[model samples]
Structure formats: C-alpha cells, structure tokens
Target chain A: MLNIKNLHVKLEDEDKQILKGVDLTVPAGEVHAIMGPNGSGKSTLSYVLSGRDGYEVTEGEASLYDHDLLDMEPEERAAAGLFLAFQYPVEIPGVGNLTFLRTAVNAQRKARGEEELSSGEFLKLVREKAKTLQIDAEMLKRPVNVGFSGGEKKRNEILQMAMLEPKMCILDETDSGLDVDAMRLVAEGVNALRSPERSFLVITHYQRLLDHIKPDVVHIMSNGRIIKTGGPELALEVEKNGYGDLLAEVG
Target chain B: MADTAVLAAQTVAAKARPAGTALAARLAELDLPTGGFTRAARADAAARLEAMGLPGARDEYWRYTDPAPFNAPTADALAYTDRESTLFGGIDRLKLVFVDGRFDASASDALEGEGLEITTLAAADAAGDHWAADLYGKLEASGQKPVKRPFAVLNTLAAVDGVLIRVTGKVSRPVHVMYRRVALDADVTVHHVVRLEEGSELTLLETGGIGARSNVAMEVELGREARFHHIASKRADDAKVGIGHVFARVGEGALFKSFTLSVNGSMMRNEGVIEIVGDDAVAHIAAAVLGDGGEGRFHHDDTVFITHAAERCESRQVYKKVLKNGAHGIFQGKILVKPGAQKTDGYQISQGLLLDEGSQFLAKPELEIYADDVKCSHGSTTGALDETAMFYLRSRGVPKEQAVVLLVLSFLADALDEIEDDRLRGDILTRLDEWLTSRASA
Candidate 1:
C-alpha cells in the first residue's frame, strides 16, 4: 500500500541531506514500527511523505497506491488517503476543533464524490470515536489545540485520523509527552481503527508504545536508512540492549 | 509649492467673500446663552475653542485626516421641516431631527412611555432642572482637553437645542433617539445630554442621517448603580462633513458602554471621552470605521480617563478601521489613570486593515499612568491580511475573494463577539458582511 524506494530528501536552504536513501515498504493489514534514536530521520520521513513545504526531495520517488506522492500538495495528499499525525500540531486560534475537523472531512469527501455528513450524524460519530480516546466533549468546542495539554493534542490527532479514516497513517512520535494512561488510550484507539486494507507506521523513540499496538515488522532506522528489519522480537532486543549497540552495528 | 499657492488663493477668496463674511457675522449674531453660571462656562469654552482652531495635517494625531476642508464658514441655519423616516426599518421610537444647528419641533416625535422623560435641552434648562446643569457643557469644562479639537470647541460655541432623556429609575424598555441631519453647506451643532438616574438602566441608539455637514457633541451622566448603553451609527453621504464628540461620566458602581459605527462620509472625526469618576465603575468603548472612495475620510479619536478616584475601576477601549480604495482612516486611543487611583484596570487596542494599496490608516494607542498599583496596557497594529492564512483557505478550493472575506470576517469576529446585545450585534454583522461582499464584487 505504501512504498519508498531510496527516497532522498534534503533541506531546502542548505545542501545537507536529512534522508539520504530510505527504503521502506508497508503492505496492507500490518503495522510497521520504525524505532530510532534522535536525528535518525524518523520524523523527517513522515514530513517528506506528508508533503510539508520547505523539504526538497533531491532524488528517488515516494508512491502511495500507485500515485506520485511528492507532486501533490498537503491537502491533496490528505485527500488521497495519506495522513500524518503531527508531532506538534499547529495551534489555529479562533477556529474551533469540530469546525476544522468537519471542514477537512468534507473537503476529502467532496473530492471523493461522497455525500457530506450532516451536523447530527457527524456529532454522533465524533462522540462515539471520542469515547475510545477518552477525549472530553468540551475540547471539541475550543479553538484547535489553543490551550490543549500535550497529551490532549496527541489524542485529538488520533480522533482526526479516525474521522478521516485514511488508508495509511504515519504517526510521528505519537508517544512523546504522554503519560502511561494516555499512551494506553491512544494505542487502543489506533488498534481499534486497524483493518485488513489499512496500514500504520508508528514512529517512536521508545519500545513502550509498541507493547500496546503490536507490530508485525520492526525496523531500526539509523542515519536516514533502515538498517535492520526483524520480527517483533527485535523490538524486545533493542529494549534490553539499547540503540547505542544498534547504532554501532549499523555504522 | 503649487498646492500651497492654490490653498493660499482659496483662503484669500474665502476671506474676501461676502457670503462667507455674512455667515461668520451671523455666527456672532446668534444669541448664545451667556448670562448664568453656564455663561461663564460657555465663555471659557468658546475662548479655548477660538485659540485651538481646526486641526491640520501637520499634527501627528491628525496626520491621516485633515479637517481643513470642513472648517469653512457655515451657511444659513435652515429650519429642518421634513424628517424622512428611519433609514434602518424595524425600529419604533421617538425620532428627533436637527437641521443647521436648530431642532425642528415638527420633525420630532413626542414621548409617551412611562418612567421616561424626553424633553429638549432648552426646555429642561428653562424648567431649572438641577440635573440639566450636571451635563450641560460638562464635558467641555471638565473632561479631556479639547485644546487641539477645534470642532469640539465650535460645537460648544454654537450649541443649540438638544434632546435630553432621563430614565427616572430602573426602566424596562430602551429609548431610541434618532438624530437626523438633512441640510448641506450648513454648520450644525447638537448637544445631547442623557442623565440616567440612580439605579436606572437604559439603551440609547443614536443614528446620524445622511446629507448633513455639522459638528455634533454629546455628554452623558450616569448616576450611582446606573447602567447606560449607547450605540451610534453614522452614515453620511459624500458631500457631508462632521465632527462628533461624546463625553460620558459614570458614578460609583455604574456601568457605561458606547459603540461608534461609521460607514459613509466625506470627512468625519468622532471622539469619545469616558471618565470613570467613582469606585467600581466600568466603561467599555468600541468603534468600527469603514471608509471607501478617495473622497471619503473618517477619523476616530477615543480618550478614556479612569480617575480611579475610587478603587477597583475598570476601563477598556477597542477601535478598528477598514480602509478601501484611496480612503483614509485614523484611530487614536488613550487611557489615563490619576494618582492614588489604586486597583485600576485599563486596556486599549487599536487595529486597522487596509484593503487597497493607496489606502492608509494611522493608529495610536497611548497609556498615561500615575497610579502605583494599576494594570494598564495599550497596543496598536496596522497591517494587511495574513498571506499564509489566505493561501491556506484558497488552497481548499475556496475562491480568492471569498477566502479574503472569510478571513476578514474572522478578524472582526473577536471584537464583534464582545457585543452583548444580540440585535445590535446581528445588525452590525449583517451590514459588515454586506459591505465586504459588495466590495469584493466591485
């Protein structure tokens, strides 16, 4: 469903390359856990795939469902079934969360020629999904992430994903700044949305988030490339032995 | 140099004119009350006004707005005979009409509501009402200095008949005073006095009609525990020129709110002076000015003086201006706190958004503090729309103009949200939306 063949991305201003040659392929019905240390191009991969501005794709191609991903805008990519759960979501003041979410959902639906959801039906669906994530109803009425705590912001991202229901989601550091309970609730929400035709790439620095959402394949990314791919046992190995050993081996 | 030569020639022509001299002579011929205690006050005010004169472009406060063209001598004071109905329908109340500085009795509607006393300022003065003295020329004598505001001084000097409405006690219904001006090429002065007695509450809606070139002034006094809400909407045609001033005083534990909305005019200067004279007094002043066309110039100056003479007084001022085409807009707001006025809270914000390249806006927010323990902040910002936000909205397939409209509407929603009256807020939003849409289409 998602393929990145030797994707090379460099900073726009400087010639410094963040992603030199990344190769990853995630098929349908499987969750891929990409664990890496800081500065390992983990979040860079997600941003490049999500089509954020200022990130130049120097070489190589990224395709999602046989369509060129790099050529599409961020909203177009979102409409084409590509979702990126941002590590730090932008705080948009004066725009309510429900209004923003409904706008995004309706934009995508209109692009797909689907009927728009009425206010009543949308509220019902949002309420049901919000229950699994432990999000309060009052949070939806506030400005988007204006005063939300770090954990609440992350859960709100997941709620958006559930509403959009994209074919592939790139969760970047979704476990950062979350308490144990919040992490469990977030992972449960992600687990419930998993399906045979949907895929998820859960990027994190710790193996603790993987305990809740079990991944079929675990990859160790070091210095812009995935150096090791193994079964779920590899995550346990890295948890016991640290990424320091893996870094030396990969280098 | 050529412009200065042309201006000198015009000044010479104005000075050599028989009609202009006659008008100026008639200004002296008018019997201005100068006998009682109010006479001394009016004499002092007139002398001050003569010294100040009209503001010029060189003045920093009046840089964007020049009041020279409006300073010409007045024409004959035509008795306003016919008052067209209210421009904004759905309003049912007594309407007072003024033309060329004279109140037209035939154009005014008599009041029949209970607990409401609506009478002319001249009548109130003749009756020797003690409350009349509390507000007549009160702002001119005691409020902020009009040393640089020549029009304010002129209004004081040429003051004539005005509407005085007093809510005896707590009143349930609102009092609408529609002051319509229907004469051109004439200098009109209106002095409105609104006295809200102790524990009284009322809403005063004042609308200035089209086709009037005048200098208007008003003074309001709120008694203890009294609540007063004043909303003024001015829509002048291209030929009209006006200078409007409002002075309000709030007693202990009283609340005063005033909003000024100006849309169409050739040249306009609106000033609001709100002084919190007693403890726990609250004052809120807001204004929105929308100017279009090269010939239209609208200026607003708001001065809020919180004496803090008593403790725990709060004052706020918000002013916004939207300029299009070659129009000019200005907003100047100042907040002052006296010495020993402890626990005084004051905030002032002035923002302007210019739509056309040739359009300009000047915003000045000043804070003067003498109190040691007080919370006061003032800020001013002038800029165009946010490019990034506009691009984001347009990228969603929304048209360019529609996206701009949405962003501008959102920009104003913050200030409009502060309005508590649903009907007033809705009316303002509807008018604003219509103006924005028409501008976008044009």
Candidate 2:
C-alpha cells in the first residue's frame, strides 16, 4: 500500500515549486494511473518519491506499507520494497549489467534480513526472468545501458523490476520512448509481474499505454493536485477529446 | 629545463646547506663493487651523477614530488610479512628472491633453465665474456642525454648485485623477481639487465621494494623480432621511500611492453625511458597507482619518456593515478618522434582520480613531432567520482562505499585493460581490490 497526504516539492537549485498539495492513495493489489499534461509535475512526483537529490519536500507525509518513506535513505527505501523505473536509465560504463543486477538483488536482500542468493542461483533466476522479456544473454553481459537502444533500455528496466520484485513499483514516462511493439513488450512484462501483494502507480501523458496495461482507476492531475478520479472510461473520453476540456471543466 | 642553477642559487642563499655536503659524504663512504667492465661504467656514471648532484626542490623533473627522503644517508627499511606469500603464486615459474637488495640463494631456484641463461651480477662480474657485457649500464648512459636522472646513474654506480637474464627462445612461464626488506635503516641499490635474442620472448614480473630508501635500475634489450613484457608492482610499507627506473631498447620489429602498479608508500617514484631504435618496433609504458588518504603523506610519481627513432614505429604511454585524503600524485610523460621517423603512431593519456578535496594530482603530457607524416595525440584529465553514477548505483540498493569501489575500478580499467596476459591481469586486479578493501576498512 502507498499513501500520500498533500505532497509538496520544489527544485532545490531554483525558487520554483513544482508540486503543491497533491493527495493520492493506492491500496493493495490495485493499479492507478495519473494522467497529466506537460509541466504538470508528473516526473517530479516520481523523482521525489524515489528520493532523488536537488528536490526538497516543503511539506508532505508519504508512506509505503506503514514505513515513513521521507525519513529513510534512498537505499533504505529501496530495501523497503519501493522501486522507481527511471524515465532515462543511467549508462554506467565498465559495470556489467549482470553485475549490477546481482549487486542490487543481494543488497536489498541483505538489508531486509534475507540470505543472499548464490551466484549460480542468481544467474539461473535472471536467465529465466530475462527469457520472457526477450533479453538475450549478450545484453546482460554488456555494461549497464551503455549503447543499449531505447527499446532495449525500457526492457532492461522491466527486467530490473522483475529482478528486484519490489512491492510498490512506480513507472514514470515508460511509454514515452517505446514504439508500439516495444510498448507491448514492456506492458506484457509489467502485467506478468502483477500480483495480489504488489501494486503499481503508472504516470503517463497519453492513454496509449493504458490501452495495453489497463488501470483500475484513473486520476486527472492538473497544476499540482488531483482534480478528478474516475474509472477506465475517463481515459477514453480524454483520449478522444484532449485534456483541454478536462482542464476547462476543472477550472 | 635544468634545475642545477636553481639548486646552486638556493645553496648560496641558504649558506651552504647539507645538500652538497651530504651527497659527497655518502658517495665517499661507499665503494663500487669489484667488476672490471661494470666498474669502469660505474666510474663514468659516478662522475655524471656527481655533476648532476641530488635532485632538489628547484629540479623541474622533481617539481611535484620532493627528493629529500631519497637523499638520506640511510633509509629505515620496514620488516615485512607479505599478506600473501608470493605475487603470482598460483602459476609455476622461475622465482628469484632477494632480501635487502642481496640475492637470496637459499630461497631462489636454480640459476639455469631451458632456453634461458640466468646468473647473478656477482658471478657475471668475475666472468670476462658474458651476455650482459655490452648491456651492463649501456642503456642508462644513453638515456641520460635528453633527461638527467642522476638517481638512475647512482643506482648503476652503487648497486648490490642483481640478475642477468638472456632469453634465446620462447619462455612460457614468467620470471618473477621478489624483493623483501628485513632490515631497518637499510639503503640498497641494484641493476638488472635482460636481453631477449632475435625471435625470442620473455615475461618478467616483480613485486615489493628493497630498503627503506631503495634505487633499482633495470635495462632491457629486445633484439629484432623479439618480444619483452615487464610488469612490476611497487609496494612499500607506510614509512618506506623507494624509486625504480627502467631503460629499454627495442630493435627492429621488436615489441616491448611494460606496466607498473603501485599501492601506497610514503615517497615513491617509478621512472621509465623506452627507445624504439629499429623500424616497425612498438613500445608501450603504462602505470596504475593508488595512494591512501591518510596522515602518512603518501606521494607517488610516474615519469615516462618514449622515443620513436626509426620509421613507422609506434609508442603508447598510459598513466592512471588515484589519490585519496591528503595524498599527492604526479605524472610526467612525453612521446618523441624523430625527424626521419615518418608514419609514427604515438598515443599518450594520463588520468587522475581524486577521492577527496584534500587530495591532489599533477599531470604533464607532452608530444614532440619532428616528422611531417605522423599521428600523435596526448590527453590528461583529473576528476572526482561521478555523483550521478554514484547515485544510480546507490538507488539500486548498493551501498555508498561499494559504489565507490566500482567507480574507482572503472576509472582504472582503461589502463589495466592494456595488459594482454589474462592471468597476470587478474592477479593484479585482485591486488587492486585488496588495496581498496584495506583502505575502506582503515
């Protein structure tokens, strides 16, 4: 479960307040999509939730499974089962992808009082998980995100999500760089990981991604707050007409 | 480019300090070992060294690292118990052990092997006709014209007997030279000569340092079509001061590659001069250095000069240094393309990683091209760890220090990747990792 009560955030290097009094809640085993136009703080929400630097929370109370997310360090939040699929995956030269994956998997496990997996077991698990994402062995051997195509980077992000198996997954602009086929593959990967104990908060601009991975609830975010909460059909209405009508109506 | 004038002025202003007096006293107290030809060579070098004097603060070449520690009358050698017995203990090879700069016959293997002629400098001194007769102290004298390395000449003049190696055929196993110090306040000098005949190959591996203040001079000659690989690890206790010099001559179509890896020392310098004399020859000199961020004042310097004399020759120089805490690192490398050396290919890169704000790195990269048709490039960079990359790794659940280790290893990979031998590379990498782990714990 994830909870947020009037989350406010601002750019640390500038005097600009990006998020102002946003309230949202997603219960267990549910998928919520926040659809917003450009400059509506969609990306800032994900970055703040993932504990990125240069962003100060002016006032907010956010929690994941009764653990105060704001008080924990980034790695601690990750160990608490909070995962953020970055909009742009960082390219880490000289660090093999497999090594990155293993270190992350083991680090989270170790922080959570779980025994680390052996190299053999980890390799076997990764291969099996990667098989469904269509990521070949060579892709796993190269450095992280170095020279990977856009689609390949998205798939690798999904592969990482599958490996970490976090309880709360936040997908930020995942569909922005993906083509139709790539979007389908990413959606399939996300859909396969959905379970009773896991939840997702998908943030996107268009309904194209929603058509593949259906969300149980849709929230219309404007400026910095949620203006409306509706069912799946609200997406189609905005898809046919644009957010122009919705913004006028909310005003 | 000369520092003698500056040193002379300083001596005048300072009212005749011990700089000259101490050097004269030290040289007068010691006598060159008895060897007819090598003694003659030592006499020539001794006079040259006396003229050059010991390096001082005014010396251009010793600008970043002070030479005061090396000028001591005697160095206090630290007793060592190698955390690991030998550097390349996993592989079977010819292992030569030295204690306090003297060859340890009881701990060394036999002096002969198939396709290899190995003898001590003491034995070679008594013999009139030997393989190293022409090589002994020859390269040192030749390397002195462009640069004045008085310490190298000092090493040649006052050496305590080293090994002479002659390779006539392929040598599959590496010859590892192990140096360990057991006495305190011990100063030792050694000179080694290695000759690889035409079409022959040899790999030399060295680890550890000799006295508290030690000077080691190594000369290598690769004949036509021959290949020589040299890898040395300079490791000293927290209090030791050591310097190593390597002079190599590459013949026609010959290949010479040398790499030095350094882990901490109070004061340390590794200088190399590589000459490509014959056409189509290739020589590469690289080094990877690490110094701790501690109170011991870790200072490291790597000075390299690579000359391309013949047509179509290739030369490469790569130096990587990592300084943490209050450590200081210096790199000075130059690639020279002679007038007639057309179509020469030269590449030089020097990089430094400073772990903290207090650490410092000084790099000087040079390229001299007299030929019209040549391709030469040089670059130098000094930077801290990438905070974004660090965050990415930490966001993925890796801890902070481990992330640093990853990035540091990546920074050094460009230089470490130059090693062609897989097993040796792996061993050196392990040593690097060990250095990282130890520093982290400290």
Best candidate per TM-score, number? 2
Against the unseen true structure, what C-alpha lDDT does each candidate score? Answer: 0.72, 0.84
Itemize residue pairs with steric clashes in candidate 2: B76-B185, B77-B185
Best by DockQ: 2
Reference A-B contact fraction recovered by candidate 2: 0.59
Best by lDDT: 2
Candidate 2 DockQ score?
Answer: 0.66
lDDT of residue A131 for candidate 2: 99
Worst 10 residues of 2 chain B by lDDT: B1-10
| Candidate 1 CAPRI classification by DockQ | incorrect
Q: How many clashing residue pairs appear in each of the predictions shown?
A: 0, 2
Cα displacement (Å) at residue A54, model 1: 3.5
In candidate 2, what are the lDDT values of residues B268-350, reduced to their tens digit? 88888999999999998888888885847788889999898999988888888988888889989988888999989999999
lDDT of 1 by residue, B343-439 (tens): 9998888777887788777766777788899998888888887765554443333345655666666666556655667777777777776767777
i-RMSD of model 2 (Å, 1 decimal): 1.2
